[model samples]
Structure formats: structure tokens, C-alpha cells
Target: MRLAVLKERRPAETRVAATPETVKKYKALGLAVAVEAGAGLKAGVTDAAFAEAGAEVAPDAKAALDGADIVLKVRAPLAAGEGEVDELAMLPRGALLLGQLGTEHAGAFAERGVDAGSMELLPRITRAQSMDILSSQANLAGYRAVVEAAAAFDRGFPMLMTAAGTVPAANVFVMGAGVAGLQAIATARRLGGRVSATDVRPAAKEEIKSLGAAFIGHEDEESRAAQTAGGYAKPMSAAFLAKQAEVVADAIKKFDIVVCTALVQGRKAPTLVSQPMVESMKPGSVIVDLAADAGGNCAMTKPGEMVTTPNGVRVLGYTNWPGRIPAASSALYARNLLTFLTTFWDKEAGAPKLPPEDEIVRGVMLTRGGQVVHPSLQQQAKAA
Candidate 1:
């Protein structure tokens, strides 16, 4: 079987799906790996590195994808009129496509007879931990958010005991306690900032405390059931959101740095930081909105850009935090793709064999056999 890796054409996307290390692993499994030239350049991997690792450095996407059985990507391929190259048109029929492709192109993939596996939809099962792309990418994003906040903030993070004067530690507040939010808390704490976090999920309280950060949230019956069976956050009711907002508004005024990572599965991110809240913050305060791509948890956020509030609060809404640290993100992401492929590989066939009855396969597979097979996507299509 042959595996193809193409350059990510999505704006602000610096991550590459396959790395030299993963290319070596695919070659060991008797699979031919073809990577487009310069595909890994943004992630610090050169064509020479891929070639040395036993991968064919194809001249372009067309060459890389030629007769490929499987295709790996950081994002979904661009459809006709979406980019300079119609990548979807170039895909070979019956190719197995895998990436963080959103549900937007499920019907197109089905029409083209391609099997599209959206890795972000992977089930949160113990056996699939290594293959979880969302967790791997979010972990890096969480760490990067704190780093960005520190750089944007005027004051230092740590409490400095100087001969001149004593500098108090910055108060960092993380809105959410999921994989990303928890990492933000830990990173902020490691940088000598006093961290606190909030979440709609009741269980996140223990997680926040474990990381030496204060937990702030209004927990009730609704909040207790805020987490889904798959470990994703559920959208809170309007009543619960109101109460949570009240608490957050009071707490955020004193926060020197705020990192917003709250997001509900398949829903717009709930606004945790209001415009009034931004006005309440002191001058030089920095807010990093990690959910910018999902409409942001801060009302002041402008996705893909940074804006300073009238009161001098800086709202950083730069999208694609994982892409900001492409080298590390690509390394982790490549391993995730490699792990998923190996788990479903058919040793005798020397190719992947996704069983129809397999939970992991069913969870990630969006389209197959000329149809959108995933129940969620089917419902989404019906609603649309």
C-alpha cells in the first residue's frame, strides 16, 4: 500500500500530518510513503530528511497522491474554487483520507468515492489514547496560550524579589479545565503565576486543584452532567450560563492574564469574557482566546488578530495555536496518525483494514461507500 502526505493549504496552518519519523515507521510496515516537496518545511522537516527516512519526496501534491491508497493531511483538502488547486478533484477514487477534516465536506468525499476519517472525531476510549488528535493538539495549544499571554503582558509573571522593590506575581485565570485548560493552568503555575480555572463540568474542580490552581465555577445539577460520555463538554443551558457568567465577571476583574479554552462539542464556544469584563480589567492585562477558531469564549476577541480594548486590555485571538509551535505539534500529530494506522493495519494485506464493527473506526469514519455513514453527520445533513 502507498501513503501520501501533502502540504497543508489552509490559512495559518503550519502543521504537517507526517514527519520523517512517521515516514520511517510506515516504510517498516511495507508501505511506500510519498511526501510532497516542502510539505514539512514549515514544521522544520526538509525534503532531504524525508528522503533519508525512506520516503519519496514527490514534486507536488499530484505526484504525491498518485495511486495512493491512503492520504494523510493536517486539514481537509481544498475543494474546487476554494484554493488555487482543486485538491479534492486530485484525490484518487477509493482513497482513504484521514485528517482533522471538519464535517463540511463529508458529502463531497462520499461523492468522490473516498473514505474520509476525521481524526478529531475519534472516540475517547482507553485503547485509542495514542490516536487522539484533539488531545495531542490541544495540549500543545494550551501550553502555547500561556506563553503568548506572558509575552503580551506588560508585567512579569513571577513574583520578583528585587533589591529595588518586590514584584507581586501575576494572577492567571484559565476558563475551562479540559485538556487544554488544565495545561494552561499548569504552564502558568510553572512560570510562577498564581493560577485559577473554571469549568462547567463538576469533575474539573479536582483537576484544577490538583494542578495547584484555584477552581471557580457554579456547580449544580446541570453542571454535574456537563461532560458527555465521550469526555467532551456539553453546552450549558442559558440559566446555568448566566450564573457562571456572573461568577466569572466578578473574578476576571482581578486577573492579570486570562486564557479562554472553553468549547462545547460541535457548538459555538460559550462567551465567558464579556466586553464589560474586558473594560473592568486593569491596564496592560492580557487575554488569550484559544477558542478563537470556534467563535471565541471572549466577546472582545477578534479571530486571527489581536485587539486592544479601550481600557488597554489586550485581547489576543490568534488562531491555530498548535501551528505557532509547528515542530512539536507536528511531531505529536504525526505519531498520532501513525498510531491510528498501525492499530488498524492488516499485517497479511500490508494495508489498513477498518472493520465496520470496530468502535474506533465507526467513531472516526465520516463517509464510506458513496455515503455519509456517521450518524451525527447524517443528522447534521438532515438539519441543514
Candidate 2:
């Protein structure tokens, strides 16, 4: 089987689809891997690195994607990057393409005579953990969110006593407390910031406290059982939101750095930080909204923009925080995709899996056989 990696098409998307190390893995699995020239350049992986990994290099996107059994990319195909991708108009015909599909581009590949897989459709299961792209990317995003927040803030993360006087540690408040939120807590604490975290899921309290960050809670019965079977936080009732907001509003005043990472699995992120709430924050404080790609946790945020509210607090809506660190991001993402291809392998025959449902396939199967198969995405599309 042949696999191809093309230059990422999304605007400002610097991440590559595969790393040299993973390309070697593909070779070991009896699959040939090809990359477009300079595909890994932005991620700091030189052409020589991929060449050294025993993979062929194509001079352009068309040559790379042509007749390949599988095509890998960071984002779905867009018309702007269509110069080399043939038959993209037939993407939905269920042939072979895989990527992260946003709300507007979900069924794209099927329309272009290609079968497409969206990593966002990965099912929550013990076996699929290695292939969970969201967790891997979110971990990096959570780590980067802290660095960005610190940069945007007026004060430093850690407290200090200069020769002049003592400077108190900055208070960092993290909302959501999911994988990304927990990581934010740990990273902030490591930087010596005073951190506190909150979530509707009562189960996250210990996870927060375990990292030495305070857990802000209303402690109601509903809050106690906020987790769904898949371990994601179920959206709260409007009544619950009202009460939670009051508690969170009071908690916000004391924090200098606010990082919001809450996201519903397949829906727009819930609005947690309101405009009035942002207005009450202290001047020179900063907010990093990781959920900006969906909607945003902070009301004052606009994706990809940096703006200061009337109160002088900075609200950052960074839609693609992980893209900023394309090197590590692409490496981890490539590993995730590689693992997905390993399940149907016939070790003796040395072939990549074809009949997907091979555990990893079950995890990320979106539309299969010309139908939208993932229940979550189906629900979302139906509602829309």
C-alpha cells in the first residue's frame, strides 16, 4: 500500500502530516510512504530527514497524492489548496482520505470519490487511547496555553523577591478541567503560578487537587455527577449554569491568568465566561480561551484576535494554539495516525490494515460505505 503526505492546506497551518520517524514505521509495515517536497519544513524536519527515513519525496502535491492508497493531512481539503489534489470534487465517493473535519467540511471527502476519516470521531475506549489525537493535541495546546498566557500578562508566573521588594505569584484560574484543563493546571503549577481550577464534573476535583491546584466548586448534587459515560462533561442544565456562573463569577476576581479549555465533544463550546464577568476581572489580567475554535468560553473573545476589554483585561481567542508548536504537534499526530493503521496488519504478510473496524478504525469511523456512521456527528448534522 502507498501512503502520501501533502503540504498542509489550512491557513497558517505549519504542521506536517507525518514525521520522518513515523515514515520509517510505515516502511516497516510494508507500506510505501511519500511526502511532498518541503512538507515537513515548517515543523523543522528537513527534506534530508525524511529522505534518510527511506521514504520517497515527490516534488509537488499532485505527484505526492496521485494514485496513493491513502492520503494524510492535518486538515480536510479546501478549494484554495486544490491545485494538486485531483478528484477532490468526488471526495464523498468513499475512496481514501483522512483528516480533521470541521463543522462545515464534514462530508467533504465522500463528495470527491474518496473515503475520509475524521480523527474527531475517535470513540472513547481503552484500546483507542494510543490513537486519540484530541488528547495528544490538547496536551500540547494546554502546555502552550500557559506560555501564551504568561507572555500576554503584565506580571510573571512565579512570585519573586527582587532586590527592590517582593512580588507576589500571579493567580491562575483554569476553567473546564478536562484533559486540556488538567494539563493547564499542572503546567501552571510547574511555572510557580498559584493555580485554581473548576469544572461542572465533580470527578475532576481530585484531579485538580492532586496537581496542587485548588478546585473551585459549588458542590451540588448535579455538579457531583457531571460526567458522561465517555468521561466528557455533559452539558449542564440552564438552572445549573446559572448557579455555576454565580460561583465562578466570584472566583474570577481573584485570578490574574484565566485559561478556559471546556468543550462539548461534538457541539459548540458552552459559554462559561460572560462579558460582564470579563469586565469585572482586574486590569492587566489575561484570558486564554482554548475553546475559541468552536465558539469560546469568554464572551469578549473573537477567534484569532487579541483584544483588551474596557476593563483593560486581555482576552485571547487563539483558534489553533497547537499549530503554534507544529514540530511536537505533528510528531504526536503522526504517531496517532500510524497506530490507527496498525490494527489490521498481518505480521507475517507485512501489510497495513484494510478492513478497518480494526479497533482503531472503530474509533475514528465517520461516514463508511457512503453513509455518516458516527453517531455524534450524525446528531450534530441532523440538528443543524
Candidate 3:
């Protein structure tokens, strides 16, 4: 089987789907790997490195994708523009495309007869843990958010007593307790910041406590059952949101740094920090919105941009913070895709054989046989 890795074309997207290490692994798996020239430049991997690892460095995307049976990418394809060609049109019909192509774009892939696997939809089961792209990417994003916030803030993360004076540690409040939020709490704590977190799911309280961060949310019978079987937070009632917002407004005023990582799957992020809450924060305070791509959990956030409010509170809404650390992000993401592909590799067929019965395969597969096959996408198609 032949596999092609295309350079990311999205603005500010520095990550690549395959790295030199992964290219070597794919070669060992009996697959010929073709990579677009400069595919890994932003991620610090050179074409020379890929060639040394036994990968063909094609001159362009078309050359890389031509005759390839499988295509690897960091993001979904982009539509044609003045100076750009339609990336989806480059793929051969019936090709297996794998990456974080979200379900909302399933119709485009289905129309092209592309078997697309969205890594974000990977099951949370233990067997598929190695293939969980969301977790791997979010872990880096959480760490980067704190690091960037610290850099943007004037004060130190750790409390310090010097000959001049005593400097207090910054207070960091995380808005969610998912993979990203947990990592944020841990990272902030390690940086010596006084960290605290809130989440609607009752189980997150223990996770917050375990990370040595204070848990600050109303938890009752209703909230306890507000987590889905897959461990994702479910939308809360209006009454619950009102109460939670009140609590957040109070907590946020005392925090020097706020990292908003809350997101509802396939929905706009619930706004947890309102304008009044932001105005209440002290001048020079910073808020990092990791959910900026999903409409943000902070009302003050401007997606893909950083803006300071008149009150002097800085709101950062960089949509792809994980891509800011491209080398590490690409390495982890490539490993995830590699693990997922090898898990379903059919030795006799010499290609990936995704059985419809496999839960992991079924969970991520978005298009098959010229149709949007995923249950959620199917429902969305029907609704449309």
C-alpha cells in the first residue's frame, strides 16, 4: 500500500501529519511513503531527513498524492481560492483519508468517495487509548496555554521573597476538567501558581483535587450524572448555568490568569466568563481561551487574535496553540495516526481493513461507500 503525507495549507497551521520517525515506521510496515516537499519544514523535519528515512519527497501536493492509496494530513482540506487549488480534489476517489477532519465536513468527503477517519472521534475505550488524538493534542495545548499566559503576564508564577520585596504567586483558574483542563491544572501547579478549577461533571472534582488544585463548582445529584458514558461533560440546565456563572464570576475576579478549556462536543463552547467577570478582574490579568476555535468560553475572546480590554485585561484566543509547538505536536499526532493505522492493518490484504463491527473503527470513520456513515453525521445529514 502507498501512503502520502501532504503539507498543511491552513493559515498558521505549522503541524504535519507525518514525521521522519513515522515515515521510517511506515516503511517498515511494508507501505511506500511519499511526502510533499517542505511538508515538515515548520515542524523542524527536513525533506533530507524524510528521504534518509526512505520516503519519496515529491515536488508538490499533487505529486505526493498521485497514485497514493492513503492520505495523511494535519487538518481537513481547504476549498479552492485565488492562488490555491482545492485540496480535496487532489485525493483519488475511494482513497482512505485520515486525520482530524471533523464530522461537519463529512458531506464533502462523502461526495468525493473518500473514506475519511476523524481522529477527534476516536473512542475513549482503553483499547483505543494509544490512538486518542484529541487527548495527545490537548495535553500539549494545555501546557502551552499556561506557558504563554505566564509569558504574557508581568508577574511571576511562583511566590518569591527577595531582598527587594515579597512577590506573590499568580492565581490560575481553569474552566474545565477534561484532558486539556486537567493538564492545565497540573502545569499551573508545577509552575508554582495557586491553581483552581471548575467543571459541571462531579467526577472532575476528584481529578482537580488529585492535581493539587482547588475544585470550585456546585456539585449535586443532578450534576453528578451530567457526564456522558464516554466521560464528556453534558450541557447543563439554565438554572445550573446561572448558578455556575455566579460562582465563576466570583472566583475569576481573584485570579491573575484564567485558562478557558471548556467545550461541548459538536457545539459552540458554553460561555463561562462573562464581560462583567472580565471587567472585574484586576488590570494586567490574562485569560487564555483554548476553546477559541469552538466560539470560546470567555465572552471577551476574539478568535485567532489577542486583544486587551479597556480595563486592561488581556484576552488571548489563539485558535491552534498546539500548532505553536509544532515539533512536539507533530510527533505525538503522527504517533497517534500510526498506532490507529497499524491496529487495523490487514497482513493478508496488505492494507488497513476497517471492519464495520469494530467500535473504534466505527467511531472515527466519517465516510464510506460514497456516504456519510457515522451515526452522528448521518443524523446531521437527515436533519439538514
Residue 24, model 3: lDDT of: 88
Cα lDDT tens digits, model 3, 244-300, are 888888778999999999998878999999999999999999999999999999998
Q: Who is ahead in lDDT, 1 or 2? A: 1
Ranking by lDDT: 1, 3, 2
For candidate 2, write residues 1-384 as lDDT tens digits: 778888876677888879999999889887888888999999999889999998889897777766687788888766635644543552334346767764355465434546567886777889878988899999999999999999999887898989999889999999988888988999999999999999888778888999999888677888878888889988888999999899999989888999999998878999999998898889999999999998999988999998999889999997788898899999999988888767556787665445654555655666566666555678877899
Residue 290 accuracy (lDDT) in model 3:
98
Residue pairs of candidate 3 with colliding backbone atoms: none
Q: Who wins the TM-score comparison?
A: 1
Question: Which of the predicted structures, 1 or 2, would earn the higher TM-score when compared with the native?
Answer: 1
| Candidate 2 C-alpha error for residue 384, in Å | 10
The global C-alpha lDDT for each of the candidates, from Candidate 1 onward, is: 0.94, 0.82, 0.92
| TM-score list, all predictions | 0.98, 0.92, 0.98
Candidate 1, position 253, lDDT: 93
Worst 10 residues of 1 by lDDT: 373-382
